[model samples]
Target: MYYNCGVGGYISGIAKDKKTKLTTAMATIGGAGLDWHDVKSYLRPNGLLSYSTLNDGSNKLIFNNYPGGKVFDAVVLQDNSQGPIHPELKKFFEKYAAIHSKDIRATGAEPVFLMTWAYADRPEMTKQLADATIKVANDNKAMVIPVGLAFANALKDRPDLKMTVADNRHPTAAGSYLEGAVIYAALTHSSPEGANFLGGCEKPLAQKDAQFLQSIAWKTVKDFYGWK
Candidate 1:
């Protein structure tokens, strides 16, 4: 079920790179929901299948069974919480962890938790978020992809990169690329320094900035997994 899981962050980046020459549907379709309830629904019966938008800007979000049930290798779960560490973050993670163990595991699929970043300006929240993520992973015995710490580490030496958007909450193009690199290292346990990528971005990223992001991602992964 590659659709629902596995390889954490790098799947899209690597998948896209592998098919760079392909035309049309070479992109990975990202499926997500408004909140935990919405996100969890996708794993159940009558979940999201597909949708479309018209030239008139009309669109619909459909929910139904996708083809080839229970065929995915693993299911990757992530908390979509925004802003500086929320007060109820722990509860939120615990609930997701429970869902992964009960529902995902029932399908013989391994659950993965994608540790995400905090708002760039709220630097202090990064460690807290990472800690909470680790706790959830340990509790559920799931793998934790520490992309947040990678972002924080890169910011220490490269704040000018402006990884997040103007609101400092969402990731910019370069930011998402760096995240994919971090996920690649976590999954492959191999250095991403040699990999050149500008993931899912329209405008070209500077070579120097891209290289630095890759290096930082590699460093963070190695440290997090004690890969020394």
Candidate 2:
């Protein structure tokens, strides 16, 4: 599996076999301060990766937004946030998740919940995020992709690597790799143990570290699914 993200890494293509190329379709519109409802607006098709907002002016918009009725194999939802587990935000999350989950299921597609990592500074949020995600996902009957667990497991061993960037919330390149790997393994049910695809962070992640994260992702996903 390869994790390639024009906007976000659906994944950087890491193939156990070097000769093959994996193609994926992903559209993202997010950053800090964006919620699941904000992202759900971009769920339309035609690869309109970005709608070309201000601040990032140099990026030329390539794909036009397609009309509605587009179908996806699975709809994975995530929000890059810090206080989402707060009492107020938790209610909002539940509301939006219900809306999006029902919409995805209505389209005959699987609804996947992306469990993102909380800041190491606010370690308490880790469990809160996981628990909240599981609760909401279960209520909606959506599969939970435990990327947060992969990050937690990876950091326990590879303390030298920075999962969050300088902001203490955003993910660094290695963090993104871990997220992608965990998502890939969860969705595919295959081990990333030997996959060499480093997504877009070859420099940030050395060969050994990349492989280490891959193993963690595989284990986390397998464990979450109760695989023997």
User: Highest lDDT, which number?
Assistant: 2
Superposition TM-score, candidate 1 onto the true structure = 0.72
Tell me the whole-model lDDT of each prediction, alpha carbons only.
Answer: 0.62, 0.68
Candidate 2 — number of clashing residue pairs? 10
- Model 2: CA > 4 A from native: 1-12, 15-23, 31-70, 201-204
Query: Which of the numbered candidates is closest to the native, going by highest TM-score?
Result: 2
RMSD, one per candidate, in order: 7.0, 5.6
Per-residue lDDT tens digits for candidate 2, residues 1-228, read 122233134253653333324334554445522243444454555323324333377665554453454545677777556434776667777777888887676656677888878787876677888988898899999899998878788888888888887778777777777877787777667777776665563444688887888889888888889996
In model 1, where do residues sit more than 4 Å from their true spots?
1-11, 15-35, 38-69, 82-85
lDDT per residue as tens, model 1, 142-207 = 888888898888888987788777877667767777776776667656666755555433444677
Q: Model 2, residue 93: displacement in angstroms?
A: 0.6
